[model samples]
Target: MGTAQAAQAAQTTQTAQTAQAAQTTQSAQAPQTANAADPGMEQAPIAYVGGMPPVMDHMIYSHALLDEFEARADGHGGQFRYDGQAWFGTDYDKLWLKSEGTVGTDGRFGDGDHEALYDHAISRYFDVQSGVRVDLDNGPTRAWGAVGVEGLALYFFQLEATTYFSDRGAAARLQGSYDLLLTNRLILQPQVEMNVYSTNDRARGNGRGLSDIDTGLRLRYEWHRKIAPYLGVTYTSSFDQAASMARTRGRQVHALTVTAGLRLWF
Candidate 1:
């Protein structure tokens, strides 16, 4: 009777152990089953849909630069000069307005060049510009159709070359400048400009072929990125018949001047 009782007790213990093992396995599988059946438990899909951010590449912008506004002393007298430009548009296309000129102590203004141009980007660092240029001052006003290319050259030199045509004659101009940093806020700049003509305009003191050249070196201290004060020396001269015309009018063919100016941009 004792042996039968012990065997029945062992069988009961075995049945309980089997039932607990089954319960544990079912508990482990319950979560997986729920995840498969419940739609909220699924991971969200990655896809490009209607809700996305906009790009700024097509946005418009504008800028203006007053490169030089200076007073010059050439021993004989004092003169005032100005060079500036403004542009409005997007990254690829723009409208450019440029003006530069000189005013003499004798209250005479000359060499005034103003332009309204359409600029198109053709390469990474260059632009092609086409438009009208008006020569206005104390002399006879002349109008011309102008085309030009301007950009950074090799070694980061700023350069511009433009040609003009009108009923009076054909003309071309080349301008270049370079900046050498002396310090974080100090710089030295060298600039040059040359003009040529196909016909003479005696009334305007212009001659055929190579007409005039202007070159200068300036040292500036930048109080701010948008403004600077500079001091420089400039040499301006006429060549060939232009020199003769200048001499005939009792004007110096060549003059060296000291300049003090401000450079501004925004």
Candidate 2:
């Protein structure tokens, strides 16, 4: 072909190519541009409401069990151990404010012992607990203090340590527990508690300042919608300064307790 003819043909081809490119671009973006009004959804922008209703539920129960044992020196003195517990909770957002406490009576029908467990959850599975207990000792009042993190991995395991202070002296205990689910209605909880006492308290002959070994198995069966019957057998013994006091007051005493109680929740 002639130079002028070839130039004309090339220009025509270029024009056709440009038109095709423009059409392809428009086709590719048409659906998106048209759907801008609907945004491919029929719902409006939803903002999570900032408020949730507070949950209020509380339970009160009493347990009547035989509390009898033989001390090395005291020997064959039996008393009934009665315990009562109650809890109240208020939840806001993700925080739960709770106050729970227990009161127990000795066999002699004297002033009962009491302890309160304070718990606040900053987030799911992370909570702080403060515990204080007062005993019926004739002298200065007995109290306990504790602060720890719970649920490091999951809700099945917990670690906590407590320091006890009283007119007599001071002591500390570190405890860890793991809950194993055996069935829908049954669970096994294994716990380890280590006790330590200050020199002054140990010297004063405080029973709890010495070392203690407690290993136990606890099982619960739900009998009603809000109540469960629980049983536990624990092997408990004391050592060191506490053990020495027990021996002088009374051998290393070994005893086992079989506890049957009702656990109720609302």
Instruction: Judging by lDDT against the true structure, name the best candidate.
Output: 1
TM of each candidate vs. truth: 0.80, 0.53
Best by TM-score: 1
- Residue-level lDDT tens digits of model 1 in 126-245: 999999999999989999999999999999999999999999879999999999999988999999999999999998899999999999999999989999999999999999999999
Candidate 1 residues lying further than 4 Å off, grouped into runs, are: 1-53
What tens-digit string does per-residue lDDT give for candidate 2 at 1-266? 99999999999999999999999999999987777766555577565556544334333223222211111111333223333344455431222122222222332332234556666666665656666666543334445554444444456576655566655457676666676778777766665656676653433234544566655566766556366666776565777667777677563355565655555554
Q: For residue 136, what is the lDDT in candidate 2?
A: 45
* Candidate 1: residue pairs that collide: none
Q: Supply the TM-score for candidate 1.
A: 0.80
